[model samples]
Target: MNTSRLEAFSDGVFAVAITLLVLQFVVPDVQSGKLLAALLGQWPQLVTYTASFLTVGVIWVNHHTIFKGLRAVDRTIQFINLILLMFVVLVPYPTQLLGRYLNSGFNASVAAAFYGVS
Candidate 1:
């Protein structure tokens, strides 16, 4: 198997996941005078976005570092990389869930745990 294609696919998945993170943030509707307050209330979304973005960045960096030392791609190596990429691609799902349920009591904890696990 060619490492080039695998690397390209992994890069595409990372890019898409990062792009999806911003899509979770919707504009807050509020009275004209309360715009600042409404924006301030979105701290959870902002925090999650920042955290996920950094996490993906670190993953990409590490992926590059790991692949750089590899002599060639093999079935076992490809399978391991696929597993890592699978989790990388799933990051946004939990991030979106956490953002949506961050203030919903029990659901918030569950979402946070899900995000933590992912």
Candidate 2:
């Protein structure tokens, strides 16, 4: 019935999800003179990474706030929280997809939609 364990587990999931977002950013292989240009080329990934990071951060804060108000967590609540954690864990995948296809015409739209749905 205690919420502490649930909150702690949720916090761990959030931390892992946020950490995974950064793994999407692979260092671009480029010559010294073209480093700036190479980095600039990955603007889409950077944008997606930032968006996903902020999204996870905001969700974590909100989850903490909501859990604080609950005196106890029931089985129903635990199941719902698991569902939420499932989605939280999935964030990085869609983020990577969106970033890779964000500028690729129709795929960009698909990726955006997928990102939104996720």
User: Highest lDDT among the candidates is held by which one?
Assistant: 2
lDDT of 1 by residue, 1-97 (tens): 7578888888998999899899888898787799888888888899899999999999999998887776679989888888988898899899999
Looking at candidate 1, what is the lDDT of residue 7?
85
**Model 2 CA deviation exceeding 4 Å by range:** none
TM-score of each: 0.89, 0.97
CA-only RMSD, every prediction? 1.5, 0.8
Determine which window of 10 residues in candidate 1 has minimal summed lDDT.
63-72
Model 2: weakest 10-residue lDDT segment is 23-32
Candidate 2, lDDT over the whole model:
0.95
lDDT score for residue 54 of model 1: 99
